[model samples]
Target: MLSTSEMTPETIEQEKLYLDLGLSEAEYVRVKQILQRRPNFTETGIFSVMWSEHCSYKTSKPLLKKFPSTAPHVLQGPGEGAGVVDIGDGMAVVFKIESHNHPSAVEPYQGAATGVGGIIRDVFSIGARPVALMNSLRFGNPGTGNVNHLFQEVVRGIAGYGNCVGIPTVGGEVQFDNSYEDNPLVNAMCVGLIRHEDMQKGIASGVGNTVMYAGAPTGRDGIHGATFASGDLTDDSDKDRPSVQVGDPFMEKLLIEACLEAIQSDALVGMQDMGAAGLTSSASEMASKAGTGMIMNLDLVPKREANMSAYELMLSESQERMLLVVEKGREQEIMDIFAKYGLEAAAVGEVTENTSFRLLQHGTTVADIPVDALAEEAPVYHMPSKEAAYVKAFQQMDERIPEVNDHADMLKQLLQQPTIASKEYVYDQYDSMVQTNTVVTPGSDAAVIRIKGTDKALAITTDCNSRYLHLDPETGGKTVVAEAARNIVCSGAQPLGLTDGLNYGNPTNPEVFWQMEKSVEGMSAAAKMLETPVISGNVSLYNQSNGKSIYPTPVVGMVGLASLEDITPSFFQETDDLVYVIGEAKPEFGGSELQKVVSGKYEGKAPGIDLQVEADRQQQLLRGIQAGLIQSAHDLSEGGLAIALAESVFTGKGLGVEVDLAGDATVALFSETQSRFLVTVRPEHKEDFETTVDNAVHIGLVTNNDTLLVRVNGTTKIEEDVSTLHQLWKGAIPCMLNRKA
Candidate 1:
């Protein structure tokens, strides 16, 4: 190993890796000052990745503070591998969402698979058993660019990892737009169960305790991925295929079980998954979090490749790997647990009293830095931001919107819109019933998974409408959170908390920074009003191509506490059931599906949210669900009342529906209003349900005939066969994809 004293300008000039690693001139100057001189090659590589925007959260941390990350039932918050929340009976739910956008763009299958693999490890690293998985994927329009290939492979990637790991892919979301043509977003969310007492903090503690490496042997895969993720994609992005970490689900399965067993063996101090910056992230973060230091010998690491440099060993983002800090005498005991599962385990380092990070190769110091300075002291910037010009343009375009001629025709068109269409074609490929605990799988308001051996159920949903965010970042941000909470409550669950994945363009661009700022403010206000804290989340910046930013997509993935017995189906079940429309309706057509189908427009600020009214409506619905008065419930979104009714009937078991409204046919049927839902109850229980809720308008009845009929003031406006609506909605995406292929 060469020291900085032995390194000279010739070697640094030849490599000049700083430009390729996304390190700016100022950053390199800072690194030199931190070392009190020029750094050798290995030291330079370590600092560049650790201090990167993807690893350090430099630009987004200031905005993240706007979120409310703590609640009374929260067992763990944002700083750990994942957030944990107590759900009564000494049980807790652990969950988080992470992005693998850049890697997925280069190698869709491997990138997406490792995204699922990494999030699952985050949960089990804290001593939880992963029970359900979900993914919110975004791609270019089906026929445009490489969308079809990206779409098909990304799905296969998620299925390959989740199915093999035996965790059910319960629920998630998928959206298509040209904005994501070059840089598709692959966000994976995993939920796990653990007893509150068994949850482990990912920290390095005890001065003499040994640090062990477990699971797969290290290799030179996905090196500098943290740096790769921080940069925007370009035509040459395909050449970075080596930065995509390959996944091995079988190894991950063994790792999850072995880690859980070891956590309960009373032989561990701390544990964490080696994700992102890999060993560099895990070791530095563990040491930083505990106010301690770690000294590691590169020779002791289990590796598949021979003659690897110290730099490659530290930065390789190898999949299915973990770092464990164990008690002084329990090294072999910990080794025995993983060895039984056929995994490699070795003591590679030990905790120290001093707060320094040191790496030794064959007993010679190769790299040394302050642990906190490496993990936590990256520079934080308050980027300049202002409202973008496009927002005002979208608002002004409203005056040119055209009128709708036929309500029935408009309903049919909106149904065929890809975002609003049925996703069964996609979810059917997933093994959603693998765990046999999935009470309500895909094609529901929220996916509900029953907690085994208990009467409790956990409801989960992830949502974000990029058009809304693009039109009005503040309102769109608030709407995303509100929609997630609405989905949870509609399933008879009280939303406990939420996780977020904030995807945007380069934050150095002031216009993009403005969107991020406004969206966070909206999410913070909504979370406080709904009393659901944001427990865990990931931030994905640099989602742009050729200087064009994608929509400000900050997805809100929410979890709620519910009971299996109280869970309400989103379909109309019985004939003669009375359908009630709750909450007020306004004609706000900013980002509605109707705008796309009928007018080809995206205009106006987002439909504003009245947080108190939204909160009141959720509580009222929950009360009705508990009292056994509400039979079925579904929130009104996208195409509004019209699409909601059509979807209510499109379910194979639904009989039919007839509605009589009170306003202009277009406004009454297609307005993208907030805080509204279509709920049904037996005709006999209608009186009691109406009494319990405010603003409950009886607008429709479930009939025996399989027809979707609508009227305004008893005049026929929309009339169509249920099966006709079903075929069109179900076939749109598959047909488009097939034709494109």
Candidate 2:
């Protein structure tokens, strides 16, 4: 209810400035005590935005610390713009995923566009050339008119920015559900390549260094954007339109080249992207990290609008802007680089020896506050938590997984469901091959991008099932990481590092907070045992609308590494190739797609993770690929055995698969078992494959005919044409989204 208009010119009270700036009373008192006086208008604005939940991670920091952030291959972890891992041969990969939820719900196009722009900046700011981009999108049913419009616009926004910037939108995931009806999530992930020595930190080191600003000019747009992201979307969300920053991909393109070139020139000390809290976060955090201070002049900054005040310039989230700390006497060299790209690089500030950040407007001091106090001293709250009653009931439910009466019809129904159906209609619009490094495109188990010169390659995948999390948060969290790792490892790569996008409902709700705590604990335990340290990630809370919260969705975006010779395709390659099942199938049906399709419910217990078994399977698969034994590999997830088999044959024409299964019908076909894989080997290498891969079973072989058949214990259970099932699987999503057959 406290509005900025309440603070009038003549009647303004210095003590109440934080209230108008959206800070809690306790936080205001803390600010006052830190400065030993009531904060001035400019100082209040800076602290308010920097200390907000979105920029400071006040509530989530303690939970984030539980994740495994440091591994042997990790060069830099959580504190940087994006995590960096040494990927061998003196090259490293930089990547991260962040959310732009509330803004996207209000203004889909600009919100989504800026999200892409901001992440790209994060990558290049660390002195890396962004190679690939991916997004994890969730919405209400796109079949409806209103939601369909939003879905289309968000896709277009992503394409417009990524395509124009020339970063290939390689691979991502999308699902339509009612939980996202009013508050859709648009999470963006970007991966970049850089030499190990060229990797830079976003720190402002050295006293008396020259500080500069470049790219787009400051404007009235996107004022208070960071604070807006810290809160929930309400009925008045549309009125916050001015808080969303507009993006210009062309300008961003120039900035990328200029920054990369300048970094190579070795004239810059540190660089930070002007995202989130805009100038406030980028400047204060950099100086604080470097154990330095700064004095900035608002008048020297390039501004697109006239008569902009100090508060507006300090907090505006203008797109395509960056702050650079350059070495002394090389200012012109840095300026000339950006100027060559037609971007203005103006001297805006200088690093100081004092430990305070001082602001100047027209040679007059406006705000002075301690650098570390503003960036590192936010109030971190340990939220109150209580487990929701519904969670226990859902987990303890006695619902039965229906019998496999008609396996063929059941496969078709599961294929048509929104979650299991093909997403070609959505991926078709993205430019996945622009950079010419995409080895395996969107339809595969995980995306593989070639490292142009070296024999090395990279793999990426994202996975999460909200229903499983809703029923059992801890298990669902562990399963998501396991699933993502399985996809990457199945594609014949060794798990290297991970980046997570944690999406949940309002954190203030005790039930929601409890879910968050449990999920993080689960994810942490799994990461440590697997040794896939979580290098970089993001947390997005307050994902509810109209008093309705979404199911817990903690999306894991993982990256893996391998030599080009180790990459494996996820498809049926040749006739007479021996088919084998790796890892055992259990009677686990909790949170399975079969339950959703047949019983119309999300019930049962989630499958528990056995770290030793999971680790053995990953090593076994990696060894097989290294030994050139695996002809093709794909993990069994979601629809379990049946769905994975169908997908393997979905892309091939005139190719059929025949498999013999002897087990419980439901468990063998659709049990949603974890850490299992379907693999094929050359007939000649069958002996070595079985000898090398433990717990492996020879199932059947690829057939040359058009008919796909499955027999359980010598009895035919599923018999259908490959083309018939392919049509239903591939056309489901297109039909729904385009409203056309």
Candidate 3:
């Protein structure tokens, strides 16, 4: 066993050992003051992880308070395993988004696969059955061989876990940029369904309750992972690969069924997933929340690796493990349930009346500390924040529109850009129709899933544009939220609420802190205007490598409610349907795909959004769709009008469009003006659709020509067969991934 003698206070003070564990000298002093004595090695490990930003949110709690987390429909928000929102009829939806960025950068496959596994446990731990899984992924330029490999492995990892667990991998978004070259972001989200009566909290109340360990046996993998994730990645990050947890989806499947069954029994008091800091966080936080304490006998804990030290067992983030507090007399019942699934369920300890977290091994006390000191009293800092001067300078710069010599060629090039290209190469490997609840699969504005035995359905999506946030954090933040709302509205669902994965850089950097502050302000404004409250979220800071940070990529995961009968498709439904643009297209090219394609970089202001206008347009679009006046609806973003129009026909449906737009050819085709959508209305309902949708402009007609024909001001600008465009879009990512460097 690892010895604690080396971690004595004399040696620690002499060597400043806490610095190696990510604790500052002041923090170590504070720990000494709190405990009124020097801590042993196990206690120090507990403090290091529990105080980490990944586990404590010490640096982000103040900023997170800015998000409005409560609404009438929100039953539980922000502080639970996942947020729960009332979906009417005694049913609720639980969902949250989490990032595994640093781990994924070090070990792509396992990092991403365990991210999916951990999120699934979060949902099920709250007694909800996970219904769907989605991901928002960002990687560096795909032309780089290393980036391609990372992208491929991340996709496979997501697919492998979700498919094996029999949950549908639904709609999501992906963006590629050089800013993510060294530190790719892998954010996973899971949506769950449950009855209102089955709601559970991770609180260990009722003194003398049995503390039980369930699921997989603990191992040494993922030790110190919380602290690892809280720090910046460096050239030596690959050495931390051992901190990435290996996941077994089959084991998770069994645990899910077993735990869900166990929750139904009255014996289960509190249950929490061993994620992040693992058992230390789960046990201490659960006890702290209930104003109680726990005395765990580490010798009784199940272990897959023999002779594991108490500290290793406490900190190991082994996948598929859970901590449960049960009614003392009824522990046998819960044990039987877990045993039925061929899993471990042992009585490891008991809840205590005193407010302390104590660990014992081999008939000796290993560590003892105040429960609140570990879980509730992590330090909070309002970091210094300063807006980058370049933000204002860029916004004031005159528009630098690149002259397009051949509009058709430019359109083709934008379509081939990795950020705008098709993602069938990724989603094709996922079983998106698992459990048969999927009503609309991927390749749409948002995914729609039907609620069995009811007319209700849900529209789900994940979205972010990090390049815009890189240029202007505030505007880009609002745009991403508005874009998520547009997608939900386009799928014929009323916006409900959202979860966020705020992945940023070191909080100690004033500029990065300012980006986080401004971005949250923007997202909050848009969410309020759109009436979508922030239900749950996670913050991932310090996403840097070698002192260079990644773009401020705050991903939004949104869910909306709809009637099964009113679901709208994002593709053309019939030939000769009248096509219209719902909002104005401006010459807003900053942070646009066109700019990136032209200059190989993005500068200038990110596009501006009037939240009120965006909200009004979204409501209009949803009303039109629900009133049966619109046939097909799609939001214009990223590659803008040209990409949206092309995507409507890329489903190999043999449908196309002919449009005559009066504007600059380049701006009309490629400008990424927000709050705009491409919609088609049947000729019979054209007048009503126009009346219902404000700012609607008739552009053309959907046709069976299988060709996309466009004329700008009586001049042919773009003409291409739908099949040809589809081929280029589909082959881009796969070809890049398979090609040699």
Q: TM-score: which candidate is best?
A: 3
lDDT of 1 by residue, 1-741 (tens): 445444453466356656656777788778778877676677777888888888889999999999998878999989999999999999999999999899999999999999999999999988899999988989887864378889889998999889999999998999877788888999999999999889998899999899999999999999989988998888899878988999999999999989999999878999999999899999999999999999999999999799888988999999999999999888999999998999888999999999899999977998888888788898888999988998977766543233799888888888888788888777988899998999998988899999999999999999998888988888888889999999999999999999999999999999999999999999899999999899999999998889987888998889999988899989888889999999877878777777766656566767878989999999999999999998899999988888989888876774889888987788888888899999999988988998999999998799978899888887899889998889999998888787744
**Range of the 10 consecutive residues with the lowest summed lDDT in candidate 3:** 1-10
Query: Over the stretch 1-741, how does candidate 2's per-residue lDDT look in tens digits?
Result: 433434442223544656656688788778879999777667778888988878888888888998989978999899889999999889999999989887888889999999999999999999999999988998986687768777888888888889999999888888777888888899999999999888889999989899999999999889888888878789888989999999999999999999999998778999999998799999999999999999999999999999888888999998999999999889999999999999999999999999799999878888899999988777899999999888877777664656768888898998888778988877888899998999999878899999999898999988888878888899888888888888899889988888999999888899999999999998888888778899888888888978999889999888999889889999988889999998788888777888877777777777767877888888888899899999999999879889988888876668889999988777888888788899999999999998888989999899888778999989898999989998898898767777621
Indicate which candidate wins on lDDT: 3
- Give TM-scores for every candidate, taking all chains together and pairing residue i with residue i: 0.97, 0.96, 0.99
**How many collisions per candidate?**
0, 0, 0
Model 1 TM: 0.97
lDDT of 3 at 106: 86
lDDT of 3 by residue, 1-741 (tens): 225656776677677877888789889999999989987788888999999999999999999999989899999998878999999999999999999998899889999999999999999989999999999999998977899889989998999999999999997988888778999999999999999999999999999999999999999999999999999899989889889999999999999999999989999999999999999999999999999999999999999999998889999999999999999899899999999999999999999999999999989899899999987888999999998887878878788777789987887898889988988999999999989999999989899999999999999999998888988998898988989989999999998999999999999999999999999998998888999999999999999888888999999999999998889999888999999998887888899999988987788978789998998899989999899998989999988898888998885779989999997888888888889999999999988988898999999998898999999999988899999998998898888787778
List the pairs of residues colliding in candidate 2.
none
Q: Is candidate 2 or candidate 3 better by TM-score?
A: 3
